[model samples]
Target: MDKIRNFCIIAHIDHGKSTLADRLLEHTQTVADRDMQDQLLDSMDLERERGITIKSHAIQMNYRNGGDEYVLNLIDTPGHVDFSYEVSRSIAACEGALLIVDASQGIEAQTISNLYLAMENDLTIIPVLNKIDLPGASPEEVSDEIVDLLGVERDEIIRASGKTGQGVDDILDAIVKRIPAPKGDPEAPLQAMIFDSQYNPFRGVEVIFRVFNGTFKKGDAVKFVNTGRTYNADEIGILKLEQEPQKEIAAGNVGYLISGIKNAREVKVGDTITHVERPCEAVTGFEDVKPMVFAGIYPVDTTEYEELRASMEKLQLNDASLVWEPETSAALGFGFRCGFLGMLHLEIIQERLEREFDMTVITTVPSVQYKAVMTDESIKWVNAPSEMPEPNKCSHIEEPYIKAQIISKSDYIGPIISLCMDKRGILKNQVYLTTDRVELTFDLPLAEIVFDFFDKLKTISRGYASLDYELTGFRQSNMVKLDMMLNGEKVDALSAIVHRDKAYEWGKRLCEKLKELLPRQMFEIAVQASIGTKIIARETVKAMRKNVLAKCYGGDISRKRKLLEKQKKGKKRMRQVGNVEIPQEAFMAVLKLD
Candidate 1:
């Protein structure tokens, strides 16, 4: 136990966390020289392409410092605000954290959030200034910033370059000396906390856990404390980037337990595992995961309904945070209402469904949770835009608000402030990190940021801004459900909740945007956006006036005019063409906002 260390790396986006992990793996000889892969822990092509860690991964390494053999367990975590919950759970399972900061960019909002979480978990955070090999690196200035933020001593902060493999040995040395070994009694009854898990079609559920007491071996009858289901432990092992079978996993060691559960639904992360006969007290972990963003996902072809559900079940084994259930749409046929941690989470799942499961799905507009107050004095929460209550039926609607923290260059502060203000943001405070860098804090509605806010922020800040947000609470706002109609037929999927003040502007912009995307028909399509009975914005797609009189050779010009008049009259009668066959692309037009 004295020679064992459990630690994970935490950082902001693009801060070289994965690079540092590779350096450590190489330093400890965890992966062979030929077998060493870039971002080995990520194990997802999407993660590699996006340059982010979407899921937390656990691995074990054998290290030796001056003949002192030590076993190190490293958990790599995602740096985005959407995956903060996952980061927290990863931190909880560790005794220390490697807080990696980009030397050029310094500490951003996500770095601060991760620092707070590490502090909350009471983990020893060793400040490591990464990316020091960059040409623009400012190690001294970043070190000072770290001191100001975390209040640690000057010399204690480590300066390392994840790219150059510098200070990798020092990092491992610091871990052995600073991070305390796991303390648990091997004589006590079995009590294991399932930190994370992975699902395999052939091998079943492989859970990553840290044992607090007793021992677990292959063929042991283990029971999940919460679900009270007993399953035989088919295998036990440690992850050396690859699962290596172990003789036994005793107290104070981190490893994987292969429970004989076939589906991913059977595995529960943040749950306790104990021996069936020698059960001990269950270890408490995180509360049930609640998805913040909700959207409806339907198969492009109705024949793929069962395949979609089966794919979702298989995907959920890998991502249990993904919440989904059956849903029906009048225009879209049958589908499912899926919940996600954030927009990126929603996108990743949709991508996995298509790329891995080969299922093409149409996703509705992603919406934040809103609290609806009814006329009868009942309060309810809504997720999807379609679930929003009518303005006349609702007493008031409260939208979810978040405390946003933004770090950027001072030169771009003006535009950021303007963008935030336009989104109904209430400025809370501002501070200068350096002469050129600034940190601005605001309380902004989550609804506004759910769409194009991130993209807009990048455009305004020249990609120099980093944002992190947390739900502050619900706030009362002048909110309304903006409904868009196509030729008098309401497209339930196009409906959205917006503030009353900007309803007309949004409505006008959306109608104009849709006008460009929706194809023109024989009958003119009136795309109108309205709040209750009041029409706020409208656009007309003129009917294709076919030259019905083109074949009238050498007749009076009035004959051609009369033929056009007859065609116009026919269009008026055919205005309601059974909801107008809207293309699948038309339904996704809302995703292309101004």
Candidate 2:
């Protein structure tokens, strides 16, 4: 067998992992003479738009060193914490990993988490300090930090500017020497881990995996160990890291399979692929992925509910991490309660659902996990806005908490700490970096920071702040489940459980924002805030009286009357409480801060 090296590149957000991959492909002459697409691993438009690696991509290249040819199977993993589970799965498929750290920014929280994951997997780690050509390039400091924090030897850090292609060859050389070749029995029973998958209308379910042991050629019958579903592999191909596909792939290689399996639900990530006749035991280390954040996703037009469902189903086929179930709302009609890894993942999914599927979505307010203790002595987990029990119905409640790390310039330390404190953040530790930058660690409730913490941090620090957080756990605390009422009628979709101290402030803010965003209708609208049965605050939206008064002067009275009728019909479609027509924008207004 050829000397093959299977390794994944891990990094924090904006650490140049994809850029470095492009550089590697260019240096290896993997790109064809006429092919010219930047960030080739970012195949999807959504991936490029977000500037995040949503999908983990694998590519193969031939490297010649000392007149010896070696094959490199390089996998690029997502840098965001939302896709951390996917990152772990991708790492498990590789024999080694390239821990790419930003030269100036040093190691981030996600970077550390990814490093710990690689260590746990026992993968050979090749430390690479990327972006060495930037104005603030500090390879020496980053190198020292790597040695100090990651326990890597000082001499092991590979310095490279993925942006300028400087010192890239050195990185490649280190990869060849530091990362070990994949070691598995090619003759053993066929076994592979399904790290990622997708659905193509022409090819059906495209299952991408790294063969751990044994391999089979085309026409091999394989069984998914977890699902017990069998399929005949009609074709197998490896991504050349360019635009074309290779004919065959083997053990220690990353590739995709066309098994004619149309159902994407059957082919799940972490599922073991094995030969049907002689299947190997399922691989260990796979864990059930639980989505930490959820939002009610609905079609902007109620008629497109089926289309939205189809789109979500299609998306879920390849993205096993995405969770969705049927959900309904009086305001949004029928939709899905989509669960995501985190806020970023939720945004990406919503954006893709609209852009890729050409369907407008009405997303409900994002909700974090809540632990409810019932008066009947029952424990339950609640995530939906409509599911939060009334304050009087609960004996006790707890909100999910997270451990957050904020790195900022020393000058902005006061503002950052103040912002965190206002959100009920408790400082766990603090460290100074150099003389001007400081890193503050806090144990804060996820509910507090989920809304606009990052935005506020940017505003306060003038975009000099970088933050990272991980879900710590839950803490028992006094909390109240607050509800929104429109003209004394409770809106289940607008309810939330907040800390008792901040309830009035949040309620007033939400009601005022909703009134501002909700356009005036044919009748007066009242936005009310409620705690249990008592109303705390209210805002009035005056009825639109002269919306079509200008049209009468144009001598298009029929058109004017039609427009008014359409407006009246649109007003009728809205949720009416007393005299108010609550627009969809009113519901969305709660997301923004005053």
Candidate 3:
């Protein structure tokens, strides 16, 4: 156990975490030269194309130092704020963390938040200045920032470039010297915590876990404490580029377990796995995932509903942060209301469903969860606008609010502040991190940032700003449910809960956007945006006219009138019975509304 060191890499987005990881793997000879590639730990095609890590990857390495062999378990984590929960879980399974900071960018909002999380877990922090090979790299400036953020000595901070493999040996040496080895008793009862999982169609669900105590052997009878289900361990192994099967994995090691459990819900992340005969106490579990965004996902064809549900179940096994339940919409038919960490997470899930499962789905407009208090003091959680009660029956509505932390150049502070204020943000505080860099704090509605706020911030800041936010509890707000009506029927899929002040303007913009996306029909279509009894905005899609007088060019006046009357009646009848086929583009129009 003294030669075993477990640690994870944590950083802000695009800070060279994965690149550094590749260099480490190469130096340790953990992966063969023929197998090595950039961002090697990022196994997903979506991750590689987008240049982001959507999932946490765990791998083991064997490194020798001064005649002594050492085992290193490195878990690479996502840098995006949406996957912070993944980082948290990775942090929990390790004894130390490598805090990587981009030399040119210095410290950003996500870096600070992830640092705090590491501190809370009491993990040893090793500060490393990455990307020093960049022409814009400011190693000295970034070194000082890391010192101030972590309060570590100047000499302790390692300057390395993940691209050119500089200082890779030093990083390995530091891990062996600085990070403490995992401490556990092999004699104790089996107690391993499942940190991550993925589904295998041929075998079953594969569970990746970190063993804190006892031993797990192949063919051992194991049980999940949370689910109270037992199964024979079909195979046990340590995670590598490929899962290397082992007869047994002892305490203080990270490995995988397969028991032919076909059901996804049978293996829960953070649940304790123990031997059935001599089970240990269930270990304390990690906090539950708190999804920031809620949206409905439905099959394009109603007949594929069961297939969609099956696909979601398999996907959830891979992404434990995703949550969902069955729901129905008047316009979109039966669907599932799925919860996600943020809009980016929602998009990735939707795309993965299409690419991996070949499941075509329609995602409704995203919204934040709100609490509605009734006149009788009953509290109800409203995840969708359709769930909101009537204004008279509800005492007040409490919407989710977040404490937003933004780090950016001081030059763009004015525009940033204006954008936040426009989103109903209240400036809480501001501080100067350096001569030109500033950190601003604001209290804003979660719903405000659910749409184009991130895109606008990136545009205004010239991609120099980084944001991280946490829920600060619900607050009473003047909220109203804005409904969109096509013709005369209210489309529940397009409903949104908005602040009273912005409802009218938002409704107007949305109505206009729908008008542009919805195709013209044979009959006139009325696009109306309303709040309860009041019609806030409206637009008309005129009916396509085919001249009935073309056949009667020189007919009598009575004959022409009769043709016109017949056309009018036909249009009215068509309008009454015809169902508008809302194109998929129209469902996502709210996201593009300017």
Task: Tell me the spans in candidate 3 whose CA falls farther than 4 Å from its real position.
Answer: 554-558
lDDT of 1 at 93: 87
Clash pairs detected, candidate 1? none
Which lDDT values do the candidates have, in the order given? 0.86, 0.81, 0.94
lDDT of 3 by residue, 18-37 (tens): 99999999999999999989
Q: Write the per-residue lDDT of candidate 2 for residues 307-418, one digit (tens) a residue.
A: 8887888888656788888988876678888888877787788878878788888778888888999899898888886777766678888888988888778899888889
Best by TM-score: 3
Worst 10 residues of 1 by lDDT: 576-585
Error of 3 at 454 (Å): 1.0
Error of 3 at 566 (Å): 2.0
Arrange candidates by lDDT, highest first: which order?
A: 3, 1, 2
Q: Candidate 2, overall lDDT?
A: 0.81
Overall local distance difference test of candidate 3: 0.94
- What is candidate 1's lDDT per residue for 477-578, written digit by digit as tens? 888888888877788887888888988888998899888877888778899998887898899887777668769999699988898888877887888553
